[model samples]
Target: MSNLIDMCNCCNGCSSRRQGYTLKLSFPKKLLVATSVLVILAMVVMPSEARALQHKIRHERRQHDAVALTKDARIRQEELRRRPHRRPALLPQTKDPAERLRNLEAERFKNATRTIQKKLKNTRRYFNEERKVLNETREYRDGMPAWLPTINFVAIHFHTYKKQGATLSERKFAYVIPKLHKSLKEFLEIFDRLYKVEVDFADDPFSNYNRTRHELIWNTTRRLYSTIAEIEENMAAVNVPEQNFTPSKSLQALEMKVDAPQCLKNDYIAFRAYGNLLNNWFSEFKCPHGKKVTTKNAKCAAYEAKLIEKKNKRNKNTER
Candidate 1:
């Protein structure tokens, strides 16, 4: 018990000695410690704050891009809705090879008919201009002297020429197209002859009247040749044979003499008559109708059923 009391006394004496001694840091050392703590705090906090700010910026940019894309899509949809909608032509559903061939032929015939009609309109316009020019000119209206022998070629040929029948058949067209071409060619030749004669007989070859007449005939000739070429092309497209025939000797022999006013009048009459004929012919010519393959037909019904079945299968897939 005495040894234990002695040990306790010794521990208290050592603790008192240690408490009496004070450890003090200088100003520089104190400042160094505070700076180190601040540096450690900045390293940890700054990185986390920077990462949060970057993530927010990235998210905002992505949102803006998405909104722009949505706006563009909506604008495109509105534009499409505002535009006129054209229904796409449905392809004919046919099983027969013969029917397909006929369909193709019918399409070609229709295209050719449309093109010919357009060309015929141009031809009629040219003829009308030519008629107007002839009517307005005093030289064209002057009568021939009563003593001279005159021939009315317009009366002889205009009515007698083979005209288009009420109904135009492909077989008849084969004959008629070539005849029309030949007749137009003859008319062109006659106009060219008349043009030369007018120039030769004019007091001043470069006079306004001469120039106007020249322009009128030139236009008429060009349009006639254009119409003839269009007819030939369409005829070939429709598989019509262009029968090769020599020019009519009788028509060729009927020449316009220089200074013959009666010849001009007759020619004008012929031009008007032929113009009427062309308008009538084009109006009458139509594409031949093909046999329709409707849903009522057995083959077409089967084809349409297959299409419907495929469409339903597609719709089912989309729904799934």
Candidate 2:
């Protein structure tokens, strides 16, 4: 065993000597190498730990900010909910019966006129197209009959003409309402008949003229019904008795002649002319002249003006 140990030691010495050096570390040198390795490991590990800490801190800060914003929004909404709501101020009630009646009539008349104007505009549009299509037909293109009753608004114009101290009277409403209704009824019947019958155009088999004719009659009929209702309501408000009247014989005769294209054209022209007359009558009757009557909420207007002033001040400050 002693000899085997001696041989191994001799072989180790020979290998070390062949390498020309034997690495040897003292206690201090060993400590220094260990310190360097520990510093390198710390340099790599500390940065990752710091980065993780920073990320955690940023996430927490974002969560804190979000919570703060939510709290602020809740507070604002609560404040708004606690605030009292305000109602708009209204015009004082007028004591004069005549003045009140006048105002009511004026307001109703204005609204009716606006509605009539809108309907008339739609009627005019449809009428243009209807006229165009009708003109294309051989019968209409040939010539309208001279004996056919053409629409003339001269009588309606004379009736609705503005006179001194003129007001909406029961007499005026009574006379106009029945005539308007009769005209509308006649026009509607004509349109209903035409809508069923195909126009004399082989190229327009789908009845394009009938379609436009339908639109014109529909708008005019609506206008007629609306005007009648408005007049009735106004009469009721003013304590005026509603009078019953039949359509005139002339209007009946016109209705009977709807079978002819010339009569249809005349009826359309009359419908449009009557619509214009009604529009003008409503516009001119009991309407305030040169001055507008309006009711404004003083408090609301003042509040709005104050807000605008504050906004302007804020903008100026920001610019500065």
Best by TM-score: 1
- The clash numbers for all candidates, in the given order, read 0, 0
lDDT of 2 by residue, 218-249 (tens): 66556555655654555465455655644334
Cα lDDT of candidate 1 equals 0.58
TM-score of 1: 0.46
Model 2 residue 104 distance off true place after TM-score fit, in angstroms:
4.4
Q: Candidate 1: how large is its RMSD? A: 18.9
25-95 in candidate 1: lDDT tens per residue? 32466889999999999999999999999999999999999998899899998777665333223449799
Provide the overall lDDT of each model, using Cα atoms, as 2-decimal numbers: 0.58, 0.50
